[model samples]
Structures are given as structure tokens and as C-alpha cells.
Target chain A: MVSDLSVLLTDRQGQPYSLTSERIKHLEYLCESTRRDIVDTLYKIGRGHAGPSLSMVELLISLYFEELRFDPSDPKWPDRDRFILSKGHGSLGYYAVLAQRGLIEKRELDTFESLGSRLQGHVDSNWLPWVELTTGSLGQGLSYAVGVAIAAKRQAKDLRAYCLLGDGECQEGNVWEAAMSAAKYRLDNLLAIVDWNNLQGGVTLEVMPSLEPFALKWQAFGWHTIEINGHDLQAVLQAYHQARQTKEKPTVIIARNIKGKGVSYMENKVEWHGGTVTKELHQIALEEINARLSELSQYADEKYGRNHG
Target chain B: MANWKKAPIREALGKTLVELGDRYPQVLVVNADLRNSVKSIYFMEKYPDRTIEVGIAEQNMIGVAAGLASLGFIPFAVTFARFASKRAADQISMSVDYCRNNVKIIGAYAGIFTGAQGVSQQMIDDTAAMRAMPNMTVIDTADVHEVRSALLFAAEFSGPVYIRIGRDEWPVVFDETYTFELGKGRWLREGSDVVLLNSGILLPYAVEAAELLESEGISAGVVNMPSIKPIDAALINDISRNVGAIVTLEAHNVQGGFGSAVAEVTAANYPVPIEMIGLRNEYSESAPNDALLEKHHLNPPWIAAAAKRALDRKNRLRC
Candidate 1:
């Protein structure tokens, strides 16, 4: 495997147009299946978090396929790239991607929100592989990631540390404290991706402008800032690649994405933040996701036929 | 003991890390701006590469310690007990304890030893908060000897360990040869009239109290209950049966310090009129260490008074 997975996202013609169609298909599946799994699991659980998890599906996909360097067989690989999900409410997206990458058993998806399952509603590092820090309490993950990044630099190791943040969670003062430390240490190997889905709980970002001028704020705090379409897999991959090339300052990729991207009824809806999908809603979500899966598969088939034929 | 010979617990902790750093390169120290006060300056001066000062940011210091621990480093986060407990408890709980990270948190300036820093800098109930966490091992060493032993023990012990240390240079009650275990309580003295269970700087006074009690025809057992969370139930049970009464003391709030931990064991297994002698749910203003203890009814005279009260209660029960 390439040290940087972004190298794998070649174009449809195998020329690497920012991102390949194969990788794009993977991103879409990650987003769809995450929503599907969360809905089904929640349906079984009788309670599930839908909004925040759906919001970060694309980021998780781009991370798993385009950035992080790790072995699924040996999850405890010391030299592996570390990923810290600071906005841990989006854990469903992480669980789906981990399962898809074979880091965890696919059946583990069913265990989510269940009593005995290692897959919990909140990410637990001890119980789950690839989770570097245990987080559900907001504002803590970034600081931990900064710690990891600083350690990597001290040891002269090339290991990169990535932290995913929620837009609403930025209201916490501790995030800025972590930002200052990361910048002070000049941890260029660290990358913080904020899922700017605009809503937190029952309120939208407009309802509470916690971090306006967010990009400039990071830049002021001594970070190289980049803004991109979070749902655009190609942009995410390209930005991640650029982030790796940069040095001396940490990178903050401000990704603007919808809370619910794949499911039409759920898109941008605040009610779906942690609302349970009833048996009836589960059917609708499942059907909608299946439709997207078929559409992407058909697109892949058409592109293959045109080129090969 | 000579004045210069009396060592602060923080000195022992810092000194232990240097010895450990020689053996294990991964043993790191994270200190706040109080390195000199916390005695971590010794480690910083000796092993500059191993020690890091996170400035005045307590929360950041904890987060950085957790991060270092995650990368297979044994980080001893050194800071004042007040800031370590209140200012950065969330990071300690989430990044450290919740993840079961191998970080030894050495809290300096615990109890009224803060002296003139007042109640703001003193940590009266830090052990209680740390004990509340499932995976955290809370240790309150009675003196410099116990501190040195506990710091070494924590290195071998897995998971998180929080050791509360006093700021003042305390007299060495135990010798360097004394073996310090993590959860086991040390039997300091044996008595039959009443059991004086105490820890931290209060042990010396408890020993004195036992001596005074002996002169008054009351044998007082002095048990140094350092490991508060894992209360030595068997030891406490033995004290309850052999001694007529039990008086728990500390330089802490009686609600959740050594008294509370002993009370939990005694309540279920052995019920007795346990007199909790410590700070009575109040903060102390800037004053001398002895004066602070005297005001909180934790000094030798106050401990003697509480012991007498317990003895009187014991005699009434016998009648």
C-alpha cells in the first residue's frame, strides 16, 4: 500500500483527475451505507444518531481511502497514521468505514448502540481499533490529536495525526486552546477537518454563530487553512494530498457539507440529529440508499462500457 | 530528621522519573510552570529531552500528557493539586482515564501545605475525584519515603495512577527500605483502645496521637491508609474488631477522603461510630500549615480531642 492512499485515486482513464471514479464510487457507498447502517442499527436499537454521523460520511470515506496509512490486519501497528474523531457523535460514519475497510468485522455494524457490542454510540479507543482517543465529550479530541502530533514530531517519526471536528463543537474554548498548542509546536504533520454541516442539536450554525471567520481564525492561530466541498470526494483527496506536502504549520480543512447528504428527506434536517428511525422510516432510508447505490453502480458500468468497448 | 534531610513528595517523584528515564527512554515528564515548586526542575535540569513544560496551561498539559501516553510513553503529568483536579479534570477523565492511558499524575501541593497560597491553591478532595474514576489508581503517600516508593510502583503498575503529594518538606516516618504497594494499606502502629486511621501529612500526628492515647491508658492503632480508593478492607475490619473505636483523619474534607473510603467498608462490614477528623466542608484562608490544621481540627490537639470523644462513645457502648 502507498504511504498516502490519495495516490490510489486515479481518474476514470487511470490518469488521476483529482480523484478516480472508483474512489468516487467508494466515497458514495461510504456515505450511503453509513446512513443505511445507522438507520438500521438505530431501528434495532430503537434510538440512533442520524444527523452528525451522516454529515461526516464523505470526510470519513476520503480519510479511509485517501489519507490514512494503516494495515487492517494489524490495527495496533505502531507506525500507522493516527486518526482522532474529535466530533465523536459522527461515530456511525467511522464505524461503517472501519467495517468496509475490513479493520473491523462487518457484523460489528449490527452491534452498534447494542448493549454488549464493542461498537458503541460513542467511540471507545480501548474497545475499538483505529480509534486513538475515547471521545464523546466535545472539545477534547483536538487537544488529544495535538498531543499525538507533538509526540510524532518529538520522536522524529513521519506518522501523521488527523482530527475530525464538528462545526457546532467549535463553540468550546478548549478547541482553540488545542489549536494554539498545535500551532505553537509547529505540528505540520497534523490535519484537522471540520464537518461544517451548520447544525448542532436542535439549532443551526446561523442560530448560533460559534466560529465565524473560522478559516481566518485558524490562519491567525498559525495553521495553513483550506476550504473545500466536504461531499466532493475529488476535492477532499486533492486537499489532503496538498496538506501532506506542506510543512511547519498544521492544516485545517474546513469542509462545508450537508448534515444528511445521501437521503433526500433527511438532508439538512436538524430533527434527524439523533432522532431514531422507526421501522417505517428505516424502510424509506434503506430504499433511498439502495437507489443511490444502484445509480453509482450503473454510472460505473456505463463509463467502463464506453471506454472498453 | 534534619531540616535539609526532610524531602517534599514532589522531589521524590521528580527524582524517581530520572532514575526510570535512565532505564526506559519512554518515561516522560509534563510539568506546568511550577516545575521549581513541584520539584520537577530536577528532572528538567538532568534530562531536558525527557521533561516538557506546558507553561501555565493545565488543560493543555493534561492533553499533551495523554497524547504522549498514547504514543507508548509513560508520562508523569506534574502540576499543583488544585489546577490538576479542577482546571483539567475533563481531559484527565476523557483522554487519560477513559482510554486507560499509562499516565502517572503526580499532584503536588495537596492539602493545606499550600501554606500562604490559601484555599485557592490547596487541593483538599482531589483523591475523591480521582478515585471516582474506574480505571484510575489514587495514591496519597504519607511522606517523602512513601512518595518515592509509590512513584516507582506506579511505573510498573498499568493504567492511570494519581498520587497526591504535600508541598511542605515532611519528616520521614518510614525508612527508605519500606516497601510501598499500590492498594495495600501500611500498618504503622498497633493499639487496642481506638484505631487512628490517617494518611498524608496527618500520619505523623496520628502516631503522636497514638502515643498520647497510650499514656492515657487508651491504645490507639495507627494505620497509614494511603491507598484510599482500594481501601484495605481486611485491615479496616481487623482494626474495627480489635480497637474499640475508629477515628479517621486527613488534611482533607471528611466527606470524601480517607474517612469516606473507610466509612464505606466499615458501614457494610463493621458498623462503628467513626469520627471523621479533617476539614469540615470548608476552605482555609492563607495561614501556616500547623495553624491551618489546628483551625480544621486536624492538628495533634484536635485529633486528641476527637480520639477522646471516640473513647467516651466506646465506654458508653460497653456500659
Candidate 2:
């Protein structure tokens, strides 16, 4: 079933852009493999961060594979684009992407949360590559991203910064501060994506809802707004393509997602937000994820030919 | 050996920043609607492109400063001490200090010396809070000379720095030729009977206390320990050895300001008979500037009296 998943995509010209789709499929595979890697590592060490990782799988794939201009080989490449995981709890997605991209050794993924692993429960730039800022406290990453964006603009550098925020985390006052500043400066080179997975820890996003016409808020704040289905790889790629044409205002891709999209029992369940994967539950999750992988691969084959062909 | 003259440190800081702006284009200043109050008006006027006025938003101002710092720019974030310390503390902790950003925080109207504005506006504990943070350089310039030197030093130094400047007209204590070194204490009036350790605007009162002690035949040594975080422990140890007892003075809360730092060091390393002369845990209710200092027992006479009391206590304990 895992073997059936294929990578395929389309470009801006509306032509059959197979490389984009293929890379995205690889990204999703990276997410699944790394998801298991993170869960197993977390289980061995402790518990607290799987649901957030699961929700941001497709979003991370689209950014890493389609949008960002980063060299995994040279993480500190000066001219390289910056990516900030504002919702740091979803760092497992980032770690998996980094590992698959060859930024870090695949073996290093197993050591996550160990006595001295660089893969902390939260993202720390001190340990990882391409992580622009060390974020865990929430609401501060957007501000940091704004700073990086402003610097890039002031220097007239071609480099851009992309920051990913969790919908639950956007309620922080500092996020608005950053949003206001990003618009005021006309930071077109900056892009902010919200992982609008409708669940927070131990409660639904509806309970503590920051969801009244959310995309309009960014539009009102002078940002180029783009809302899409987060789980749809094609939609995610399309949003990124459109954001590039944005001239004066910063772009916000508010990707609506589920807490646990693929796994059956975990879907939209707040309990999965930060829970440990028990061996029994882990097996069930693997089976469910395997089924989804096959479904994705079938969709890819119907849309585009096989990778070799 | 040190220059002892009258220069307001706040003015020197402004001058030094203006010069720095000329030298480095990346030197940016973000004012929290306190451009004139903190004397950053010069930087704003001189380099309009580099200066940002965040309009009374201390939290956003600090957040912006931290962001700018992360992007390899030297951002001097300025605001009145009260707002910078009390209001924008979270941003300081998360964005600037925790992230180890090269951001400098210039605090004006620090302490009760903000004249008749009362305790509501006057920040007396900004230095102490800044000092408590990791990798933070907390400085209180003695005079205009030291302020100039401190600005240059902060520019060269990496990581976070907090400079507390007085709002009222403060008498210049350091001379034009005075040298300011990072983490080093300056010994002004050296004596053996008692040691008066102080920093910021209170250093002037400490000098006056030394003169009064001399008139009474009490050899009081006055040390200007401005950099509060990486405290002058060597000087503290030397004072404990040379002077019989020690008296710490500052126009701040006795609870955690300069005096509290000195007490913590001296008590742990060498238990000396120490007297702390500062505000008596009471908020100011808009009194005349000088009257408030006298009322809080932070004036020269009060400091001198405290020194003598400490000396007597040391002698009594020795007996």
C-alpha cells in the first residue's frame, strides 16, 4: 500500500508539471516515514506531539517541495530563503522534511528526544539547519519572520522568508503586531501560512474560536490573502504560485486542515493533538496511513504518468 | 585616575548613537513615542530612514526591535523605563534576550528621578529586571562621559544590553577624560572605614556622601558599580577587605535594585555588615523631585548616615 503512493503535480502554465507532483508525493512519503520516526522516537523517550505533526503534513510538503528556495546541503546559505515554524509543536513535520531532504542524516531521526538529540520537542535553531529562529512560546515567530523580511527588503536582497503558524496559536497578540508591521512595510517577499487545523490541545478550535472570517482579517490587515484546502497538494501548490505574483502586500495562505487527516480514529480528535502512539494504536495508524498512501498514489497515476515514464 | 565632571549620560548616549549611525548604516533606532523624552530625536532626525516610531506601543516596539536584531541589524529600542520594563517585559524575555538578539534597550526616565511624574511614570526597577536575564548587559552610566563610552562599548559588544538613563536634570559625575570599561567598577573616593557602592544617578549623591564622611573623619570609599549584571565582584571583594563595612545606595527599590545585587554577592561570598540606603518600599505620589529623594532617604545625607551606621555595626560585630 505504501509503495502505491506516487508523486505528481502541475505548474503555473497549466501544463502537466510532473516533477512538482512527484516531489510533493515524495514529501508526503517523507511525512509518513518521518511521522513514524517521530512517533516511535517520542514513544521511547516520552509523549507529547504527534497530532500537530500529522495535521501539517501536506502543508510542509508543499512549502519544502514547491515553494521554498533552500538548499538542504547548505543550510546556512546566506542567499537562501528562511522558513520559520511559528507553531513549533508541529516541528515533527519540519524534522521529517529536513531528514528526507538530506539536511540531516536519516539515522538522526531515531535519536529524537533522546538524552542529547537535537530534535527537541520544540524547534531550536541552535540544533537544526534552516530553522531561522528558535520558537516554542508561540506568537513570536511571525514577529521574527517580519524582522527577517524587513531586513531582506532593507538590504534589497532577493531572499524571502516563509513562516508557518498554527490557527490556535494565532490568537497571540504578537501575531497581530507582526501582521500589522508586515503589511505597513509592504513586505511582498514575505509569506505567512496558517495550519488551520480545527483543534487545539484538549479543546476544539470552535470552543476557543479565532475563526470568524479569518482570511478576511489578513486581507483587512493589507495582506494578500489565499485560502485553500490544506490537504490538497494541488491547491497548496496553486496558492504558492499565486502568492509569488503579489506585489506590495505580504501573502497569507490560510490552509484549512483537519487535526489528523489520514488516520481514522485520530481525525479531528483533539486528544490526538499531543498524545503518545501506543503500540496497538500505532499499528492501526500505520494501516490507515498505508491506505491513504495508496489512494494518493492512485490519484497521482490518473493525473500523471509513472515517475520513470 | 577617572574623570569626575558633570555630564548627563542620557545626552551622551544620544550623541554616541548619532555618531554610530553615521559610521554604520545598519544602526536602527525604534522609539516608543519617546523620541524627545529619551533624546533619540537626534537619531530620528539625522537618519529618518533608519529610525522607526512605533507610536506608544512598547510591546510591539520591542517585538519589532527583536525582529530587526535577528536580521543582523543593530536596533536600539528606546522607551521610558516604566513602559520598557513593566509593559514590554514578555517581548524582552522571548524575542530579545531569550533569542540572544543583538538588541540594545535604552531606558529613559528610569527611577524616581523622573521628577514630579510620581512612581507611576518613574521606573525604579528596570535595571534589576534586565540584570536578571541571561546574557544581558545592564548598564547605568555615571555621567555624560561614561554614557558615551557605554554606547561605544555596547556597539562593540554582542547580545542584549539595557542602558537606564535618568529623566530629570542629573549632575554629571564622570569627567570628560573618564574611561568606561565593560564589567569593571570605578573607584572614585577610596577610604577604609566604610565603602559606598552605587550606580546610575545615585553616584552623584554617593560622592556627596563621601565628602560628608570626610568632614566627620570617616574614611568612606565610593565605588561606581554601574554594570549591574556581570557585577564587579573583584571590586566587591576588595571593598569587603579594605573597608570595615559596606553601604549600597541607589534611587531604586531596595528590594531588588543595585543594593539587592550587592547584598546577594556580599552575603554569599563575604558576609559584611551592609546598609542599604534607597527607597523604603513606598511608591511616590507626585512630590517635588528633590523632596522625593529626601523623602525616600536616597539623598547624600541619608546615604552618609547609612554608611556611618554600617561602620558602627561592623565595629560592634567585631567586638
Error of 2 at A270 (Å): 1.3
Give a tens-digit lDDT track for model 2, residues A1-309: 233233344432234544454545655665565555655555665565777887888788667655677666688788788888989888776787777556787677777766778887788876666677778788888877777888788888888878999998888877887888888889888899999988888698778855668988888889999999898876787787777778899999998888876777878888888767778887887777676566565443422322321
Worst 10 residues of 1 chain B by lDDT: B1-10
Error of 2 at B306 (Å): 0.7
Question: Per-residue alpha-carbon lDDT of model 1 for A1-309, expressed as tens digits?
Answer: 112234443422234443346646656765566567766766776766677877788788677755677776788898888899988878777887787656787777877867877787888887777788888889888887887887887888879999999998889878888888888788888999999998889777788855888899999999999999998877887778778867889999999989877777778988878877767777888898888877766433323211212
Identify the runs in model 2 with alpha carbons over 4 angstroms from their true place. A1-27, A209-211, A294-309, B1-9
Q: Model 1, which residues run further than 4 Å from truth?
A: A1-18, A278-288, A298-309, B1-5
Q: Please, what is the whole-model Cα lDDT of each candidate in the order they appear?
A: 0.79, 0.77
Q: What TM-score goes with each of the models? A: 0.92, 0.92
lDDT of 1 by residue, B1-319 (tens): 1122466666676677778777778888887788888878888888887776667887878888888888888888888998887688888899888888888888888888775788788888787788888888888878878888888888888789888888777767888797777567767788778889886778888888777777778778888878876778898888777785899988788878888888898888877768988889987789887677677887666787788898889889879
What does the lDDT read for residue A150 in candidate 1? 77
TM-score of 1: 0.92
